[model samples]
Target: KEIVGVTRDITEQTKLQKALEEERDRALLYLQAAGVMLVALDQRGKITLINSKGCEMLGYSEEELIGQDWFNLCIPEEERDKVKMVFEKLMDGEELPYEYFENSILTKDGKRKIVAFHNVLLRNQEGTVTGVLSSGEDITERRTAEEALKRLNEELELRIAQRTEELEAFTYSVSHDLRAPLRAINGFAQALFEDCGEQLDEKGKGYLKRIQEGGTRMSQIIDALLNLSRISRGNLTLSEVNLAEIARSIMKEIMEQEPSRKVNFLCPPRLMAWADARLIQIALTNLLHNAWKFTSLKEEAVIEVGERKEGREKVFFVRDNGAGFDMRYVNKLFSPFQRLHKAVEFPGIGIGLATVQRIIAHHGGWIRAESTLNEGATFYFTLTKGG
Candidate 1:
C-alpha cells in the first residue's frame, strides 16, 4: 500500500510543476506583446526586468538593458539627479499609487526620446517596499508634431503683422499721393472747357475732354486698388457657397449692363464650396465679366463654369471661347495694372485678375490659367481643403 501511494504522489507533483511552468510562459508572452513599454527596477535603481518594447524604446538589447542602472542608463544627465531622488523617495515607504510625469530618456544611439511614465511602487509578499514598476509611452512623434505646428503658427502671425503694416503704407500712397494730382488735373481741364470754350478750336476742346476722361479712369483704377487692399485685410466669414448661383447672378448683371449681347453661359445646377460668400461672389463676378468683355468680337460666345475631380481635389474652372491671350504673357495676367489687350480691344483698369488672385490666395487656394491664342482660356482653382 505505501509503495502505491508514493508513485501516485510523484505523478501529481509532476502535473502541478508542468502547469506552473506553462502559466509562467504565458505571462512572459503577454508582457512581450504589450503595446506600452514595461520595466521593473530594484530598490537600488538597477533594472531587474525589461520587456521587448522597453528595450526597443531604449535602442538597446534585452541583455544590455536588463541589470543595468536604470537612472544612469535611461535618464538624461541633467535630469538624472532629480529622478533618482524621486525614486529613492518611492523606495522609502511612499504611499503614492502612481507617479505620472513626462521626461526625456537617453537612447543607445545618443539621441533622446520623450516618454510619459506611469510609475508605481513595488512591494514584496510581506508588504515591504522593494522597487518600482513603470509603464512608459513613447511620445516622440506627437511632441515633434506639436512643436512644428507651434512654429508654423508663430511664423504665420508674424507675416500677417508685417503685411498689415505694408498694406497701410500702400493705402496712404494711393489715397494721398495718387488722388491729389488727379483732382487738380481734372479741375484744370474742366476750367478750360468752361472758361475758354469759344476761343478753343475743336481739336483743343477734344484735348480738354480727353484729359478729364483720363483723370476719371485713373480714379477708377485707384478705387480698384483700394478694393484689392480691403480683400487682403478683411476678416473671412466661411460658409457653404453655391458657385452656380453666384455665376448666374454675375451673368445677370453683365446682361443688364449690355442688353444687346447674346452669350451662352453653362453652369451646373449645384456646384458648391466652403468659403466666404462675399469674397467668392466678387471673384466669380470678375472672371465672368472678363469673359464677357473678351468675347465681344465673337459672333457666338460660350462660357462654362463647373467642377471636375483632379486627384484628391475638386478643381473648379471657368472656360471661355474668347480672345485668348498668349501663354508667354500668362505670368503677367494676375498683376495689377498689367494689361494684355490694348485699350481699344478691351477697356479695363487691369486690377480684376489681381483681385481674383488675392481672394483665392486668402482662401488658402491656388489659381492657374491655360490658354492658346484665339482658341480659349481656362482658369482653374481649388479651395482650401481643411482649415
Candidate 2:
C-alpha cells in the first residue's frame, strides 16, 4: 500500500484531455463554416444552437437567434401556426419517419426566403427525445429559375404554332393561285403543238415543245413543294416500319418506269425504322429514285439499301455506282430548287432532295451525301427512335 501511494505524474492525462477538447473545438468550427444552414431547437422550440450559416441565412447574429423561440422568431407569420403545431408533435416524441419539408422564413431584414429543410430528432443515450436538429438549403433562386423556364417554353410553343399556321396559309395561296396559270400555259402550248404542226418549221415546233416541257416542269415543282409542305404540317403516325419492304416496292415501280436500264438493286430482308409510314415512304422514294436517275448513263449500275452504325448511331444509307457530284457543292444539296447536275443531264427541278431533308428533319433526324465525280454516290440518313 505504501508503494502504491507513491506520487504519480498526471501531466500526460491532462495533455490528452486538452488535445481532445481542441479537436472538438475544431470540429465545431468546421460545422459552423459549412455551406448548409444547421440549427438545433430544444423541446420547447427555443433555439439551442445555430451554426454561422444558419445565422447568415436569417440575417441575424448568433447572440440574437440563440435562445429565441424558433417558430415565433424565424418562421414566416403565415406558416408559424402550422410549424408550432408540428413542433409540439415532435416534442411529444411522436415517431416521425425522417421529416423533410419546405417553408418560407422571415430574415432579420424582414425579407422572406424559401428554405428546404431536412430534420432529425435528437435523443439521449437512454432514447429520450431531447431536441430537433435541422439542416436547410436556400431554394429561392432554383425555384425562380424553374418557373421562368416553364413560362419560356410555353411562350416558344405558342409562337411556333402561330408561325406554322401563317406558313400553311401562304403555301396554300401559292399552290392555288399559281397553278391555274401554269396549267393554262401548258394547255395552250400543247394545243399549239397539236393543231399547228403543219404551219410551223422545225425550230418553231421545238420552241413550242420547250415551252410545254418548261410548263410541265414548273407544275412538277409546285407539286413537290406541296408535298414538302405537307410533310412538315402533317401529324406524324409513329410505328415500326419495314424499310426493306418499302425499298423493294419502290424498286419494282422504278424498274417498270424504265425497263431497258440495266440496274441492280439490293436491300436487306428486314431493315426497320420507327417513323410515320407515309413520310418515310416519300423520303425513300426520293432517295432511290435519285439513285436510279443518276445511274442511267452507266451500262452496268448497282444500287444498295442498307443500315449500318456510325459511332453509336444507326445510319441508313442508299448507295449507288452512278454519276456522283463535286463535293464542293454539297452545301447546297438539300436546298430547295438547287441542282448540281444540268437539267438536261438529270431530269428534275431539284425539289426531291429538299423534300427528303424536310421529312428527315420532321423525324428529328439528319441526312448527308458522299459523292465523287463519275465514281458513285452514297446518301446516309438517321431517323430517331419513336420520333
TM-score of 1: 0.63
Please name the candidate that would achieve the greatest TM-score relative to the true structure: 2
Q: How much does each candidate deviate from the true structure in C-alpha RMSD?
A: 10.2, 6.4
List model 2 lDDT by residue over 10-106, tens digit each. 9999999999999999989988888999999999889999999999999999999999999889998889988777777776776364387788889
Q: Against the hidden true structure, what lDDT does model 2 obtain?
A: 0.90
Estimate TM-scores for all models.
0.63, 0.69
Error of 1 at 286 (Å): 0.6
**Residue 93 of model 1: what lDDT?**
72
Candidate 1: pairs in clash? none
Worst ten-residue run, lDDT, model 1?
A: 1-10
RMSD of 1: 10.2
Model 2, which residues run further than 4 Å from truth? Answer: 1-6, 34-50, 58-139, 201-203, 237-239, 259-264, 295-302, 308-315, 320-332, 361-387
Q: Top lDDT: which candidate number?
A: 2
Predicted candidate 1 versus true structure: per-residue lDDT over 66-103, tens digit per residue: 88998888999999987887778778876363388678
Residue 165, candidate 2: C-alpha displacement in angstroms: 2.4
Candidate 1 C-alpha error for residue 65, in Å: 3.5
